[model samples]
Target chain A: MNKYLERLYNGLIKENPTFVLMLGMCPTLAVTSSAINGLGMGLSTTVVLVFSNLLISAFRKVIPDGVRMPAFIVVVASLVTVVQFIMQAYTPSLSDSLGVYIPLIVVNCIILGRAESYASKNPVLPSIFDGLGMGLGFTVGLTLIGLFRELLGAGQIFGFQVLSLSWFTPITIFVMAPGAFLVLACLVAVMNIVRKKMDAKGKPLAAPTGCITGDCAGCGMSATCTGKRTADHTVKTE
Target chain B: MKELLLIAIGSAIVNNVVLSQFLGICPFLGVSKKTETAAGMGGAVVFVITIASFVTALIYKFILANEYLLRKGIDLTYLQTIVFILVIAALVQFVEMFLKKSMPSLYQSLGVYLPLITTNCAVLGVALTNVTKEYNILESVVNGLATAVGFLIAIVLMAGLREKIEYNDIPKPFQGTAIVLVTACLMSIAFMGFSGMI
Candidate 1:
C-alpha cells in the first residue's frame, strides 16, 4: 500500500509526464484551447493508460522479449479502441471536442514510455497505480494550462462566462498555438527556477537528481572532486 | 486536378500537419536537430501517412460503412483505432522490407524512423480524421498526401533552422530544447497568418 502511494505521488508531482519530463506536447498543446477539451482529452487518455498498463503488466512475463514492443502496442491500441467506443457512446460532446486527439492517445509517448519502463517490469497493482497517478498528473497539468488559456483567451472557464465585462477584451492569442508554447515555456522556466532555489538552499530537489540524459558525467549540476577534468568536454560546442 | 493540387498545397503549406494541426510533434522536436535526419524522417512519415489513409478509407467505406454491417449491429467504428494502428504497423513493415531489399541506402538513412512512424500520431490521426470527416477515397488520399507533405515541410524547415542555430551564440538556459521551442512558437504564430486565408 505504501509502495502504491509512493508511485502515485511520484507520478503526480515528482515526475509528471507533461511539465517535468516534457513528453507528448502535441496533444498537450493542440487540445488545450479550452478547459473542457483539455479535461476530456486528459480523462480519455487516463482511461486508455490505466487499462493498457494493467493488461500489459499482467501479461508481461508471458510475452517474449523480442516481440515486446509490438505486443505492448497491440494492447495499447485495443485499449484505445475500447475507450473510443465508450467515449462515443457516453460522452459524445467530449468525443467530438477532442476530435483526433483521443485516437492519437495511442501514439502518445507517455503511455508507451510507461508501458516499456514501468509496467513491463512491475506487478499489475503497481502498474495500475502508476497509470492512475501519471494520468491524474497529466490531467491536472493539462487542466491548469487549459484553465489559464480559456480564462484569459475567451473570458470563460469550461465554456461558462467566468469573467465578463465591457472592459475585458480577451487576448485571442491565448487560445492560439503560440499561447500553448508561451504557457509551456513559462511553466518550465518556473519549475527550473524553483529547482535552482531549492538547490541553493541546500534542499533536495524533487525526484532523483540526475541529468536529462540519465548520465551524470556531463551534467552541470553534478558535484564531484573530478568535475574539473571534463570541463572542456562539457562546454557547449554551439 | 487543379483543385486537388490546390488542396495538396493548401494542406501542405497553409495548414501544416505539425505546426498547424499539432500532430507528430514527438519526432518534430526529437528528430529535427539535423537536416538529413529530418528529411529522412519526413519521407518516412509521408510514406506511411499516404498508405494508411488509403487503406483506412477503404476499410471504413467498404466494410464499416456498408448498410449490411450496420443492420447486423456490427458497427466497426469501435475498432477504428486498433485497425488503424494495425494497418500502419503492417504498412511500415512492408515499407521497411521493400527499402531493405531494394534501397539499402534509403533504409539506412531512414534507420529507426521507419518503424517509429508506426507510433507517430500524425499517421494515425490523418487516417482517423479522414473517417471522421467522411472524405471520399480520393479526397482522403489527397488529404493524407498533403498532410504528410506539410509535416515534411515543417520538420525540414525546423531542421534547417536548428542547423543554423548550431552556429549562433545561444543563451545558457535556452540553448537546446528551450530555444527550439521558442522558435517553434514563432513559426506557429507565423503559420497562423494562414488561418484566415483558407
Candidate 2:
C-alpha cells in the first residue's frame, strides 16, 4: 500500500509527465488555450491512460517483446477511440474544444512510455495507480498553464469572467503559440527553482531521467547519487 | 484551378499547420534544427500527409460512411483514431520497404525520421480535421499538401534562424532549447502578421 502511494505521489509532482518530464509537448501547448479545454483534454487522456495501462499490464507477459511497441500502440488507439466516441456523444462542447488533440493523445509519448516502462514490468494494481497519478499530474500541469493563459489572455477561467475587462487589455498572445512557449518556459523555470530549494533543505527532488532522450545510462546525475551507486561506480571505472 | 491554388496558399501561408492551427508541432520543434535536415523532413512530411489524407478521405467516404455500414448501425467515426493509425502505420511500413528497396540513400537520410512520423499527430490531425471540415476528396488532398508545405516553410525558416543563433552569443540559461523557444515565440508573433492577410 505504501509503495503504491509512493508511486502515485512521485508521478503527480516529482515526475509529472508534462512539466517535469516534458513528454507530450504537442497537446500540452496546443490544447491549453483555455482552462475548460485543458481539463477536457486532460481527463480524456487520463481515461485512455488508465484503461490502456490496465490492459497492457494484464497482458504484459503474453505480448512478444519484438512486437510490443506496435501492440502497445494498438491498445492505446483503441482506448482513444472509446474516449473520443464518448466525448463526442456526451460532451460535444469539450469534444469540439479539444479538436484534434483528443485523437492525438494516442501518439502521446507519456501513455506509451508508461505502458512500456511501468505497466509492462509492474503488477496490475501499481501500474493502474501509476497511470492515474501520471494522468492526474499531466492534467494539473496543463490546467495550470491553461488557467494562467486564459486568465491573462482572455480574462476568463473556464469561460467565467474572473477579471474586469476594463482594468486590463488581455495579452492575446498568451492564447497563441508564443504564449504556450512563454507559459511552459516560466513553468519549467519555476519548477527548477522549487526543486533547487527542496534540494538545499535536504529533501531530495524527484529525478525522472528515462524520458525524452530515453538514455538513462548516459545521464550523468543518475550515476553519482541514486540507488544504483555500485553500478554507477562500475560504469565509471570501466 | 484558382480556387485550389487559393486553398493551397491559404493553408500554406495564412493558416499554417504549426503557427496558426497548432498541428504537427512535435516535428516542427524536434526536427527543425538543421536546414538540410529540416528540408528533408519537410519533404517526407509533405509526402506522408498528402498521401495519407487522400487515402483516409477515401476510406471515410467510401467504406466507413457507406450506406451499408450506416444501415448496420456501425458508425465508424468512433474508430477514426484507430483506423487512421492502422492505415498510417501500414502506409509508413510500405514506404519504408519501398525506400529500402528502391533508394537506399534517400532511405538512409530519412531512415530515422520515417519511424518517427508514424506517431506524428500532424498527419493524423490533418486526416481527422479534413473529415470534420467535410472537404471533398480534391480539397482534402490540397489541404493536406498545403498543410505540409506550411510545416515545411515554418521548419525551414526556424532551422535557418537557429543556425544563425548558434553563431551568436546567447545568454547562460537561455542558451539551447530555452532560447530556441523564445525565438519560436517571436516567430509565431511575426507569423500572426499574416493572419489579417486572409
For each candidate, C-alpha RMSD in Å?
A: 6.4, 5.5
Question: Per-residue lDDT for B3-35 in model 1, tens only?
Answer: 678777777878788887888776787678779
Write out the backbone clash pairs for model 2: none
Q: DockQ of all candidates, in order?
A: 0.30, 0.29
Backbone clashes (count) for model 1? 0
**Residues B57-153, candidate 2, lDDT per residue (tens digit)?**
9998888787788999987677777888889877877887898899999887776566557767788889988888888899999999999999999
List TM-scores for all candidates, in order.
0.86, 0.88
What lDDT does candidate 1 reach at residue A164? 77
